[model samples]
Target chain A: MSDHAVSRRAFLRAGGAVLTGTLASTSGVLALIAPSTSWALELEALDAHQGATVLQFTRHVFPHDRLDDAVYALVVKDLDAGAAEDPTTRRMLIDAVRRLDEASGGEWLSRSAAEQFVQVQAMEATPFFVKVHSTAVVSLYDNDMAFAHFGYPGRKGDPGYIHRGFNDLHWLPDPPDGASGPVPETA
Target chain B: MDMYDNRTTFAADDDGVVVVIGSGAGGGTLANELAQKGVDVVLLEAGGLHTTDEFIADEWPSFSQLAWTDTRTTMGDWRVARDFPNLPAWICKAVGGTTVHWAGASLRIEPHEFRARSTYGDLAGATLRDWPLSADDLASYYDTAEKKLNVTRTNGLPGLPANNNFKVMHAGATRLGYETCHTGRMAINSVNKDGRNHCMQRGFCFQGCRYAAKWSTLYTEIPAALQTGRVELRTRVHVARIDHDDNDRVTGVVYFDADGRERRQAARVAAVAGNSIETPRLLLNSESSRFPNGLANGSDQVGRNYMRHTTGTVWGVFDKPVEMYKGTTMAGIVQDEARHDPKRGFVGGYEMETISLGLPFMAAFFNPGGWGRGFTEAMEQYRHMAGMWLVGEDMPQADNRVTLSSEARDAFGLPVANVHYTDHANDVAMREHAYTRGAAIYEAAGATRTYRTPPYPSTHNLGTCRMSERAADGVCNGHGQSHELANLFISDGSQFTTSAAENPTLTIVTLAIRQADYIAERMRARAI
Candidate 1:
């Protein structure tokens, strides 16, 4: 098992009070104090503050040329669910977020993307970093949106790639004649 | 054609049927061949019968649908143990087995590979042995298998067009002054044949071909066997143990149905083709008072001598985008290095085959726990990567074995298989040589950077239940029959005497085709 294989039961028990306290200021208060307000109270696994931290953390881990926050949010959704289920993951994320804030001189969430990127890089070897990075690597690029954004011709169905861009290599120089020629019709 | 679903129950006392325990290349092909010969066969597959339509082109979801994600423990000093301990072998659980997830690299083992012990001489700490039957004995069977699979570049079918990945490899191989670089002889269709569609070059060959262009038994052999009306394929029937009679001959199989109910299907002759891992695990778990050491395991080699090919991947970063994931996962090969050259510091040789993984898989497997600028930069150049996989002949060590784990129990409460492996000195040397050569090939082709990835979870599992001329040497005989029990047979890659450099699927299919004839003859003669 990986080091991130945290005890879900232990985490839920130990952090139950902390999670309730965190939610009290956000969703709990929104429900009691401003139930009829124009703002819809969004119920998420992670608190608004933690969710913001993770979204920023994921983008820094896998910063692309043109990837936006919407793309990185896909990863946050999974992490939020994971933190909800496994208290260890929740605690880890909370602790890591606090440490990042301290490392950024108490301006992690308010700091520039460049400063936040350095903080994430400094803690690359941490379990929180590994868990989030590994999770985001798959969650971020596995969608149809990511494929289109990266210009990857997603899986071929129906007609297949034979008549498509299977052999269309206009970007490359032509090889020797026989290199791309028809295969010999013999054993 | 008669196809029975798991819902259709079979009687526990019906002992007249020939029961095959898997439905991949070995079991599926064997069932079809036996059915063609007017024999009654009941093929039991542990997974559902997922058709081509159910195949998702996406990597992770397809993996969830196709991969055998059973709880199998991994031990020893091998890299896979550290990186992918839960998934030791990347085989499929679906009806077609691993064939559905294969890259379709159809290659015959070289003649010298069949005589590994005699040709390579003695090596320290290696349990090398020559196959009981030579390549000459299997020539006709290979020819038949090639025709059955409709392998490209054979039977008047042209090869697949070279993709950009292949073009990169071709330029590198040419610069290295090595010939024989071409679109490989793949089981994937280059043109329409056998009522299946031609190669679409969909690039997700590992994720199950949606077009049925790849020769998977799910779409090919299993369907053909069903058409014969002499075979019954029951999916989601996981065999737990093989039952033997008083004389220690396998009489039937006891398995769990899809609903987790225990059921027994009696057999006249039971052939175990549940791959190398589960095949030996089933036999070992079948230990009775008569066969105390497990059925046909008197030589103590039933689960010993497990061999996965010496494998790694080398990726080249070019200035221009390669778009490697546009064609078939693997379509080209450089066979120049697949020769017996002891001077290269390793007794056996390897093949450099073109391979491409989608960005999702590449990120997960490129460097398992990698991060930072180096890792992020690689992903940034995902479209500019050209990669090739190195598959070499790894020495089979006695210590590198598969045993029943007393600690980890599977979903069925049965003890899961514990795969333990340590790289032999020969394997280490071979990998080092291949890495250097691979990096040089990329450099010669103007690659700015080349990254050598460590070995991932094995797909080419072989040589757990090997064939030997003498009963004392191995678990099975030349015809894949258990040496101790006449009615029991070992199918799949487990019957390989030595792990050859070539992909084992082609040979496994050929052996199954040949074994069907031998089994039919024995049944006729009443040899047992």
Candidate 2:
């Protein structure tokens, strides 16, 4: 069990106010909102409980401390859309939450974060978990929020990094001068 | 540049024109060189044309925009077949083919690599054969190719400045007592020349260079060929089969246009350059009564001896940040390992090139189906990581091949190519040694951790329709002409007799240039 899972569980225990829209305000609706971020999503096929479990499962799979719940929400948003269109996918996710609840002695969301981690780990190789894990791997890291958090400055603006310190490494000792050697002639 | 002649279309019965089936490093350059010799050519590309401006900076989107996402299958015990079962080779289908996605490391094949069978001797289960021509035969052509591509470290062009990734590799290689490390000979321009802009170090070499700094046939050869007014470039045209006459000589090609309408274009000469897999697939699908097995497959060697270089990735994590993706995707090299020595437990050698993957690609490919804290912790240190790619000659096995799949049929109702491969013993030893050396380099450079990643989908595909001097030994002759059919030619890496330790683009282009001269001379003598 990671610290992130514990903190996320602590936020959810406080009357679930962290997820405000359609989660805290409305009842019996499938929706979620990131704790500190302004990102929110509504599921068309999955229930509120199923959607929340998918979010929790994605975070447990990738579990980065610096990333907000919003990054994991991106995975939930995609999985929810997939569930909305495909009945097979919807059933798979619904069955996934049911199994998780059973594994956690019924009502997975109310279980301790450590127990939830064990439950997710036990089902990591299942088709339902594989779908969520694979989708989360791409959706979590490819976006802007993950880029900023991971310190990957993807694609500099305008003319690229030609003049913007492409070779600025001050930590290591520099190599001997002309270490690249001379140019070969075509003739 | 108004490079495409959209208003022009060759007639179905135009037998005087040479039809090139694929627009890529081989076909594109061959078409332009042939047109320069007053020959008419029809360059057919399976994918649509994407100009430089349309190229995106992102990874997944660029892959979708350029990759050859055809319905193909893979078999055998290779890692690619297990990791990426559907995608065996990472070549492109667009106008420029894989050249659009290449990292621009243009290296010439070493002299000894051309005579692999003779120098390395016969090893068990390895179907090694010496090339029909030596490096001396290709030296002039290589010179021409280097100048045409405006490759750095040649023609007095300066090498690219050492980026952070290169600095890490240089320091590590120097510490390891490897003296042949450098910024490498890359096709990406270090200065503005040849009407193309210099490299901006944009770090997306595999996703189509947006500034035209890296040489791609999409902007260089195809456009130049179209400007000759003797060439017709067609896009979104999928070639299905090569048609032959009663004499067993190739006469035309059958293809499906963008609208899925079947069209036939007659040709005096038909050159196949659809990379290794499809080149053999097209020939096998064109089986006729005169040539029952396949066109030019007299020895039944149309799709055997498949080789994708023994490759793997190594990433070193350090306390200090090494922003790898801040410059060219592949910017440096250590050439000392690229020499044959049987004492090293491998018949051939490998090169260690500096490589960088953006965050999206890294997550997707670092370890497919990898997760947990062990995986995320390494990825979390993305800013502090430096990467290198190990590419070496993998011995060709007769059973490792690309055959027609009976299960998977493409959109054009043609059976797709099923690529089957298994790593040979030499390949396994070479990769293991390279991994140990790569890890040692990182450890010498004060690394905290190192990850030896399995090879990604093959970007260095070679040897399916191979060349040979004897007709009974292989498919094509020294000039890439079909041993049985004088009018048929193979103008791609498919004609490689043996896989070399160097990159194949420069060699493929060199062969295409030499083939063009042979084709022109034969046409003048009324040979075909």
Candidate 3:
């Protein structure tokens, strides 16, 4: 099949992804046997029954819209994937999220959106919060590098002046209030 | 006790000179260009001479130094970027601004980026407009900038060998009807220029280039500005206010040195060169009865129209080791979506980029979930991780603005910049459109996993002091001259009319050079 044909099919499948529906349809046996999540220690980072981690963990079980779950999970997966392991990194990650959950007093998933935002901002003040945020952005950047690896489009173009009407903007309205301060047009 | 308390005033009997605030790319270049012509200058910068040694391999310390240390920073509902506690909006207050730690992906505005507003009309709740300057007007300046900053990355040899990734993007482009366009043009030196060597493909350009291959103000303009001996750089000096007379012309500036004691210097003219975000923050923070609503803010537009191009990225896994982390942070780009697409539902386009990956520790914390042994399996796949992002145009919104929060104060006792913004439906729609396009490319590249993210904060913030033909219509005029103050000018992104899809460093540099000519001519006429 053509490349377009394949991704379109995958995208269509990736969409219409109802989490509850998938959970209901898939048996726990199937969930346990998923490719990316076969390891027990990987699932034990957080108190699995707790607040946001539980929601976040389940969200990761079946990748959907919440990019962080997949991103964070994959980061841990990759760090340990290599032969040279860094245990401190793992401890920091688990501790960071747990502290974040606890500092908010376990009201993560149940908190109002506004409160969640407030707590998230406060957490960001900590190095752990900054670490997660930066890691997520960095992961996304890595993702882009991979696209470039295979040759992608859209990363081309100049830094500024992306306007189509760049030439026709000649209809420069006279200065507001008719105060023609120094425009010094460059011909 | 707060830091910078040892700041002391230095009064020179010589009172004739122009003062440029925030000596990064914009201020640094303008200062050099003007100083080369024998104009005395005082450049104020908040961050100090942080040598490369101060830089660690970690992202936190590096980011705090490279990114905006401003605590009031926040990212509002920018999808995946919302994960950032603060605004993913990163800009440095250092000598070179963000260029001190940029991926070195400097590209010029395509002929289209300068006039999105005229082509697309008023986008929903956003205020997009035509810049007073044209791409043709900036063409010469871009070349001059290229020569000075060594913007010569692609010298024939294809950047990023045609991997499965490019194959996909190319196929997607051909399928999506963007065949006329190809890869992006960058400021990276593919070949040596003017005594600088080509990029070593070190992939750590953002941490401050040592070989001088990367063009940062610290490497180029500041050295030149200092060479002229007409420019005085005050590192770690935090400018507090632009003092103005009854006539509203900036007469001098007050600042605190790194040690934090008060000091002031007189000036013949003042150019605020801090980039879009903090430039306006400084102006709005400076309040006086003579310029009641803040210096040069007669129309109350000092910090209005804050913007960031709605960035979208498509990520997936490939089967091979692309080794994308080996070269300059950004060596390739996609320009197919570089223009406004009326049919695409927004007046903006996006620039797709091939970004580099992080080191082991950095990547470890960032790789997507699965742990211990499973995580190790993913590490083996680290060489396969691939992605691309399209920086689509975002409109200038009056209500989506930056204001000094009365309650929020920074370490300097200055009010913090409170960004009030919500992604306009148009920007969000464009983000979706760009992501869909990116995802198509990823799938074409034979991606086993694919997803789209609406970016929250990545540098490239502009339009807080948007330019317009009218004074009341914008905080500054087409020349970036403060509408209310005759002797005040801005050489930063704050004066942009619309946030272009491309990274803004080159544009900021071009405008600074252009402003130098304008200010010089004006000063020559007045014999200042």
lDDT of 3 at B317: 62
Compose the digit string of candidate 1's lDDT tens values, residues A1-187: 3344445434543444211112123333233333332332132446667777887788777776465455566787778767767668878988888888888788598998787877887888899998898789788888655665565656643345555666666554555545454532431
Model 3 agreement with the true structure over B23-82: per-residue lDDT tens digits: 777898898899877778887888877654455443445666676667665535544234
Off by over 4 Å in 3: A1-187, B1-13, B52-58, B79-82, B153-183, B359-381
Q: In model 2, how large is the Cα lDDT of residue B319?
A: 98
Candidate 2: Cα lDDT at B343: 96
Residue B269 error, candidate 2, Å = 0.2
- In candidate 2, what are the lDDT values of residues B340-459, reduced to their tens digit? 999999898999999999999999899988887888998899999999999999999999999999889999889999999999999999999999999888888888999989999888
Interface RMSD after interface superposition, model 2: 4.1
Worst 10 residues of 1 chain B by lDDT: B1-10
In order, the Cα lDDT scores of the candidates are: 0.83, 0.87, 0.61
C-alpha positional error of residue B420 in candidate 2 after TM-score superposition, expressed in Å: 0.5
Q: What does TM-score give for chain A of every model? A: 0.68, 0.74, 0.38
Predicted candidate 1 versus true structure: per-residue lDDT over B1-528, tens digit per residue: 233332223366877778999999899889888888977888999999888888888788888999999999999999789888888999999999999999999999999999999999999999999999998999999999999998877777777888889888888888898888888889988777778877777788998888888999997888778777777788888889899889877888999999999988889899989999999999999999888888899999988889999999999999887888878889698888899999999998999999998867887899887765687777777788899999999998888888999899888888899999999999999999998888888888889999989887899999999999988889999899999989999989999989989988999999999999999988888884
In model 1, what are the clashing residue pairs, if there are any?
none
- Model 2 chain B: weakest 10-residue lDDT segment is B1-10
Q: Model 1: runs farther than 4 Å from truth? A: A1-43, A102-107, A110-126, A156-159, A170-187, B1-10
Per-candidate clash tally: 0, 0, 66
